[model samples]
Each structure stands twice: as structure tokens, then as C-alpha cells.
Target: MRERSVEHEGRPADPDKRTLRLQLLTVRNRLTADDIEEAGAALAGWALKLPELARARTVAAYVSVGSEPATRALLDALHARGVRVLLPALLPDQDLDWGAYAGEGSLTQVRHAGRMTLREPAGDRLGPQAVTGADVVLLPGLAVDAHGMRLGRGGGSYDRVLARLERADAHPALVVLLYDSEVVERLPAQEHDRPVHAVVTPSGVRRFRTG
Candidate 1:
């Protein structure tokens, strides 16, 4: 992951998240429950088709509880296919750790920095060198454009890690997961921002090659 430059100025203020939440709620209503389920199936199908996903020795994905459907489909597919998974572990220092996910039963909710994460203790901390060998990294974000520019939750943690990956030249391709409606035509961009290589939605997956 790369470091964020100049702080994430694009994130809306607290009031903005509130407003976005309302808008997202409206969008959610437009989608029937069955539609989301079908989309999840479609997303999983497309993800399994990716050569990277099929061959990845190490796969990283988020734990989605409420609105995040992409993670569920991805995690389930990877587990069924016997691909190794590394889930995010919150550290005391505001950094992320990679740990093996045993199964759905292994997850437990734990509070960290006022947020909840599915805890799965990793034996030891993984260094940059260790993650460099990963084949693909499934990124979580609110929105992503076809260019792969992503709008995240504003901590810049993911950006920091991605920056490190860029310097190491061992960076795995980034895939941002978004609901179909979250895919926008454009978003605010900054010089420090790194575009994802792909955007996976419930309906389908779109590839974005970088120069």
C-alpha cells in the first residue's frame, strides 16, 4: 500500500457522510434483496474467472458486515476454491496486519478505534517483504471510477500501504469492490492517489489498465 499525500482532503465532513448515507439508502431501496443476491453470484463468477484470483498464493480481502456484499462473495469463493486468504487485522498503531482466515466460524467482532473488525489473530506481524509476494489485493472503498481512482473512508491507511507497494515494485494489482451504483463516471482526484487496476461490482467486473 502507498502512503497518502497531503492528507485526504476530499472526504466530506461528518455531515457529508450522513448525507451520503441517506443517498446510499435510497439507492439500496432501488435494489431488491434478490437483486443483490444475484449480483453477488455474478460478482463471484467474474472474480473466479480472473487468472490472478485463480492463481493467487495469497489473497487479501475485507470483512464486510452490513452494506459490503463484495467481500462476502469473494471470501466464500476463495475459501471454496482452496485459495489462501489473509484478512485485515487492526493494530494499535493504526496500521493493518495480515492474518490467515480459518473459516467463517473463526471470526469474532472486536472493537478498535471506535470501529468493529472481525478478529483473527495473526501469529506475527507481516512486513512489507512478506506482502510483496501477494498475487492480488481486494481493496475496499465507497466508490471507484473506470480509471480506478477510489474514494475511501478518509483514513488513507490503504493509500499508505499501496504507496509502499509501488516503491517495492512487488505491488499486487488492486481491485476495488463497490456496489453497482457506487461506480461513478468520475471522482475528485489528487496526485498522491493511486488508481485501482479493477473495479468489481455485483453485476460484473471491469478492468482498468494503467500506464
Candidate 2:
């Protein structure tokens, strides 16, 4: 098993970090359709509350391939607002292949990461180059805190992406998505952990300043 990369407070994350993440996935599965709709509504409202988000021209959002938290609502909202949307095409070696998300019918699924995807072919894809055009980036995370530290699935996909963003001098308001209760006062951070600029939850959005 992968060792815990984050330590919360004085305690490192439980040795079962992987198990916990998988369990979170299970919990996500148990959410009723109504619950998912409510959660998506809340998240969309929360996104709208952020002034910059309303003004963004391009955004990177996930396609809810299956039981994962549905991002279709948010993506539709963004598109309705005349914003361009992008979805990360899962690539081998844990890298991201970004492509334009024109709308629902534009996506097709093919195996990439042992999971399904709603993606378009990314011809001549460049990670940093793709992100340079985005004004907002919605990142997936297992958990988050008030301070904006994100716990990902531990694949290092996001870490590498964020690092590329930094290298390209892209500060496009990093936003991590999480459940309402996932935002705590603190979360563990290691030397390599990259912090986000804000977090989006079912309840609302919280911005984080330098710690």
C-alpha cells in the first residue's frame, strides 16, 4: 500500500488512507439521485458566488463518467454562460491529456485509466500549454481543508499538473472540489504538497491565502 502523504494535526492520516479513499468512493455511490442533484446545485451556486469564476473564459472540469460526483450540471452552467470547457483525458504514466469539451454529445469513451471517460481526442496535447488558456481549474480531490490543502487519490496526477501550472506561471484560481464536511480547519502537508487557492464545497466556497 502507498504510505500516507498527508498528516492532519499531530496525527498522520490513518494507515488505511487508500482504503478510506475507496470507502469514500463507496459512500459516493450510496448518494441518491436527488442527493446528487442537490449537491450539484449547491456546488454550482457556490461556483457562481466567486466573482472571478463568473468571469472566466475557459475552464477545466471533469466529466462524470459514472458514479462519481456529477459535474455535468456545473459544466452545462459554464457553457450556458458562454465559457469554454475542457476535460482531462486520462493518459498513461499518470499524465493528463486535455481537450475541448464542446458539450454532451462531443464526448466518447475509451479505456485509459482502468476507468471510463467522457473525452475527445487530444491531438498535439501539451499539459502546460493547455492550462495556459484556462481562467479557472476545478480539481478533483479526496478531501480538502479550510486552508485549501487537497488530498487527491494519491496518483500524483494533480500534483504534476499543478506543478506544470506553476512552471508556466499560471495562477488560474486553483479550486478543489469536496463535500461540505470535508473542509476542515487543517490537513497534513508535506514538502512536495501543493496548496490550492480555494476550495468548493456543497455548502459554499472558501478562499485560502498564504500560510
Candidate 3:
């Protein structure tokens, strides 16, 4: 079946995931522009302090959209640090291609068919395998539990990226950026689910045990 069909399923239609995503998205949608801006700045600051990003030579990340945490600041900061930042360009099949982020001017608004508009790179496509070369991969997620389990937006794009990382034996540090409230007590996980190494929120950073 299609990926959108399982967006709420959270793997086998788990009610826990459905409820958690709904709750998280609702809060995100209600966030005021100022709330999002302030949170984004705070998250950028905390993420910059990460030892992983400081030491990273190549990082794979995505741009934030709508009421999501402000990633533009963080993205600019990383680029200014002379870090090689790779942004994703979604393919037609819901897979992602890689591209270099030069600056705000390098991005173009893309209205994907039957999906939301995304600010993607207006540059060359480096193909999906480019992610294997990254030392760090910043993921976009709704919530993450203590065990590092992430509740994604149900597009299954990141899911495919995770699987690709596994197949390539790419052990880059996986990190999720979120708001303080998104860090919850628990999140249900599945057998195929992979754990993230760290989460950077507006308040602070939290590390988890992952293998």
C-alpha cells in the first residue's frame, strides 16, 4: 500500500502512536509564530553545543516548515561553521535525494503533488546514497521517548532513510530536534524501529542508549 495510508498506523495501526501524533501535531499547529521563533532559536543554541555537531565534518539535515521548530537558524549556523550541510530533496516515490545548502538563496519552494510545499535545495541531486557519508543525520520527528523511539510525521520518508543507513552500515549519530514539551515520558516502538542517539530541544539536550 501507499505510505500515507500508514501515516497514523505508526506501524500496524498502533493506537498509542495515533494518539501521540495527534496530540503532538495539535500543539505544534497551535504554536504562535513568536512561540515557534523563540523555540527555534533556543533549539539552535542547544544543538550547537552538541559535541557531535561540533566534531561533525558532514551533516545531513532538513529544513523546518510551518509551525515546526525553526531550523533556518540552525541550518545557517552549521553552514557558517564551515560544516558540510546536506539537505534533502524528496523524490517522487517518497525517497529523499541529497543536496548542498549554500544559503537561503539556494532554496526553492516546491509544491509536491498531493503533499505540502517544501523548501528544498535548487541545486544538484546527490542521490539517496549520499547520506551514508554523513557523520550526523538530524531527523524531524513529533515525539521521542526515553528509549529514543521517534514518532515521525507518517510519510515514511525518514523510515526509508533509516533503513538505507542500516543497509549501508552507516553509523552516523542520529539526532532529533524538537520542542521541550515534545519530550514525553514514553513512546511505543516497533521491532523495525531504530533508536536515535540524542534529542535537542529548546530547553536542553538529552542522550539515550541506542545500539
Candidate 4:
């Protein structure tokens, strides 16, 4: 498949990360359904090529909402492959708890008062520590830097997830899925930031160093 390499303009490493995040989100909000569908299909194809996912017994992943790069394709693909896919359920404090992904029907739309609606598992709740068992984790992000620092929606949910993994000494191969244009030159660093091991974009898969 031919990949579109339209680099996003005005993508500076702005010290005010909020500005950079909004810039990326604004562009993503403009994507058409066709654009999202095509990107989703290509992303699934490219991500499945990764051995981390293929060999994983358990994978921690999230469902994409709205104009973000769709994740339903990848979620279904992973479940179909017999991998125990765990999806997140948001806690009142913004930390993530997990639940199994049986299929599309297993998810329910959950609306947090001040947050985007998330499709969470309709089944039993697995504690936050359940993520420690995952062999790989597919994170949702608006952008990732050349250094693999992921620019999440600024909710700080994944920050907690990453910290939990660190505290527990769980070394899952963390991966971010994004549109090709969202991979940028740099991102403003945060004291609590953690790097990912890989990123799967519409164009291809990229490996990064993570400590």
C-alpha cells in the first residue's frame, strides 16, 4: 500500500505542550471517514506484522473515539488471533482499570462528565494491576516525538499506567498507534514522561529505545 507522508506543518516543539497537542488534535479532527477507514485498515495490517503482538498472550489496548485513528480494526484483529485483549475502564480518579475484550459487543459506551466518551468493557472489572501481565500495550496518542515520547490527550491516565508498570517492574513492549503525519520532530518533555518501545503508523512500524 502506498503511504501518505503529509508532514503536519507548524509542528514545533513548543514548550507549552498544550498548544502542540491542540494543533495536532485540530488536524485530526478534520479527517474524513474515508481517511480514517483507510488509515485504520493500513494500521491494522502494519501492526499485525509485529512479532510482539503476534506472540503476546495478553495485550493491553484501548478503543479510539471520534476523529482519532480508529482502533476497532486492531482490537478485533487481536481478539480474533486468540490473544487475551484487555481494554481499559476509567476510574473516578482518572487511573485505568482493565477488562477483557471478548468482541465488539463486549464494550459499552461510557460517558465521563468532562471527558470524551469511551467504549469500555461490559464484563467484569480487572484491577489496574492487571496491566502488569500484558506482553504488549497499545497506547492511544495524538502524536509521538522522534524520541518516542508520546503526546497523549493530556488526561494523564496513561501516565499513571506507565508509572504503575514501572513500579511493578513490568516490561511490556509499549506501542503507540498514530497517523503518519502525527509522528513529529519533537515533543515538549515532562518530568513524569515515559518513552515507548515502538510506534505503529499508517505508513510503517518504528522501533525506539525505552529505558
Candidate 5:
């Protein structure tokens, strides 16, 4: 099948993902606080209905920062269900380490050099490899195409996470969280870019067939 493309403001589609990322970020940065809250609640409602998440014994997720689709509700929901929720803690090298989410109270604000501050789990660190134990991994991305290809911020953190999973032969359900507008028709992909199994938006869920 041919790759699809999403038109921006009736303008021609840009094949360069960097340009697209900037456009998407511009739109996201415009979101109001109320808009973020409503989208977060709706996203949580839709995401919690996913079988992958519902049946998951352990979920690897992140705390949403800035204008990203809010994941606080979903994280708390998973915790309330008695599921083991693992949140990522950024290492000095821009890689991620795992930590258990105890609740909203369990998170601590961490500022990293040359990066946006993050809200990370305050519990003991669980080593980077702990993600291999998750039944589902919720990834943070700027956008996802119809083909499930994700466009992430330049940081190579999740790329490392995916590579580690491959090395360990782990097959967790990989999911991306985004806004409805961020679910586009296509995105430029590199050889190292991994297709996600599904994406959860405020409106609904979209799954792709993956090998």
C-alpha cells in the first residue's frame, strides 16, 4: 500500500519530518490549559478501554510534559487497577531508567540539562532493563502516521528502549499516545524508526498490523 500524507493548513505536505515536527509543536504549544485537561480525560477514557492496557500486568509509561497529551489520568487509572506501572527516569546520557509509580504523590520534578524538566517516579530506580518486563509500553511521540510510524522529538531515548527490547527478545505491546490531530496520514521514517502497535488519542484508538 502507498504511504499516506496529511495536509497542513491546506498547504502541500512536507516530506521533511523536522518541518512537520515544528508545525505540530507549534499547534500543540497553542493548546490552552482547559484544552489539555479535557483531552487528557478523554484520552484516559479511551486508553483505559484498550485490551492491551486492561489485561496488562505491568505497563511501562511516561509522565507527559508540556503540551503533550496528558497521561496523568491514565497512569493513575492503571495504578488503581492494581497494575504495576513503571515510569521512566532520564539517565545522564539521555537514555531512560525505570521506576515504579506509587501515585501522584510518587512523582518528583527532575530538571535535566539541555532538556525539558520531567515529572518522574520518586521510587527506587529499577535499572533500564526493567522495561523488558512490561506487558505494554506506552511511548511518547509528537505524531504517528497511518502506517504506525512514529515521529518523536530528536532525543534518541525511546530508540534505545526499543533496541533493548529487541536485544532481549521482548515483545511488549508498544503504544503511542497523542492528540487526534497528531495522528496523521504519513511520516518520514528512518531505518531505525520502529512502528508502534497502536496509538491512543483523545478521540479513540488506532491499531496497525505489525510483524
Candidate 6:
């Protein structure tokens, strides 16, 4: 995509980050239901075989909404294997509080900010610190570059999640789920940004040395 540098006449215009996010969102919105389904199944095939997930006793993952690559199959597969799965519940401050995933029926639709509804766990909230015990953390992102820098939806929620893990000295295998097309050559990075350990796409898994 071309870099957007033009500024609006009357306003202090858009930054490169905002421009990139809009571009990626447009691409994501173009994905069809069938495309998402196929990618989700393929992603499960690649992700389930990873050693990190296979060895994980506790996992932190999320439910995919809208045009994002589906995580329903992968989530179910993890739960079926008796893995302790944790899903995030959005807090008023935009930080995440985790809860145990009981099953498909255990999730409830929670409307947040009057913008989007999230499928969150219906059980008790485990607090934000709960994720510190996870062996692996599956992140939702718009794209991940070769350097494992993830382009999130600009909510800054996961940024806090990563920060919490860091403050706790937790070292879980951080992974991002995306479609093959979302694996890009490069992405803009900020100082607060953290690198992921791997990215699981529809085609395969790409590992990175985050140390």
C-alpha cells in the first residue's frame, strides 16, 4: 500500500499509523464468510501442531469477531484437549480481565462502548493478572511483519496485556493468529510495541526470535 502523507487543510491530519490501520481494515472488511471459514480451519491445522500449544497447560486466547480470521475451531480444539483456556473480558479502561472458557454455551455477547459486541465467558471474571499463568498467549492482530511486530486494531488493550505480563516477569509464548495475506514484509513500530514469538497463519507458522 502507498504511504498516505497528505494532510487535511483545516485539521492536523492523520498519522502513518492511522493510515496503515485504515488500509488494513479495508482489506479485512473485504473478506467473505467462506474465506474466513477456510482460513480458520487451515489456521487450526497449522497452529495445533505447534510445540508451544501442544505443551501448554494454560492458554490465553480470544474469540474472533467480524472479518478477523476465525478462532472458534482452534478454541474448541484446545478446550477439547483439556487445556485450561482463558478468554478476555474487556474492562471499562480498555484493559482485559480473563475468565475460564467452559465451552461454546458458556460465552455471552457483551456490548462494549456501544460499538461492538464481544463473545466473552459467562463465568466469573478472573481479573487481569490471570493471564500471567498462561503458557501461551494467542493475540488478535490486523497483521504481523517479518520482525514479529504486530499491527493491532489500535485499541491499546493488548499493549496493556503485554505490559502486565512483563511486569509479572511472565514468559509465555506470544502468538498472533492471522490469514496468510496478513503476514507482511514490514509494519510501523512504536517504542512501546513488543515483538511476538510466532505468528500462526492459514498457510503455516512463522517463528521469530523475540529476545
Candidate 6 local Cα displacement, residue 124, angstroms: 0.6
- Runs off by more than 4 Å, candidate 3: 1-12
Candidates by lDDT, descending order: 3, 6, 5, 4, 2, 1
Q: Compared with the true structure, what per-residue lDDT tens digits does model 2 show for residues 114-149? A: 444444434444453686678998887767766677
Candidate 4, residue 112: how far the Cα is off, in Å = 1.1
Model 1 lDDT, residue 60, Cα: 77
Error of 2 at 31 (Å): 1.5
What are the runs in model 6 whose C-alpha is more than 4 Å off?
1-14
Cα lDDT tens digits, model 6, 36-58, are 99999999999999999999999
Give me the displacement of residue 12 in model 1, in angstroms.
11
Give the number of the best model, judged by TM-score. Answer: 3
* Candidates 2 and 6 compared by TM-score, better number: 6
Residue-level lDDT of model 1, residues 30-90, one tens digit each, is 7666776676677777777888888887887767544455356668779778877777665
Model 4 local distance difference test score? 0.84
- With candidate 1 superimposed using the best TM-score fit, by how many Å does residue 110's alpha carbon deviate from the native? 1.4
Compared with the true structure, all predictions reach lDDT values of: 0.67, 0.69, 0.87, 0.84, 0.85, 0.86
- lDDT of candidate 6? 0.86
Ranking, TM-score, top scorer first: 3, 6, 5, 4, 2, 1
Off by over 4 Å in 5: 1-15
* Per-residue C-alpha lDDT of model 5 across residues 11-90, encoded as one tens digit per residue: 34445976887899899999998899889999999989999888999999988888888888999999999999999988
**TM-score per candidate:** 0.79, 0.82, 0.94, 0.91, 0.92, 0.92
Local accuracy of candidate 3 as per-residue lDDT tens digits, 1-211 = 0133345324457777888878888989999999999999999999999999999999999999887899999999999999999999888778889899999999999987877788888999889999999999999989898989888877778888899999998899999999888888788887777899999999999999996
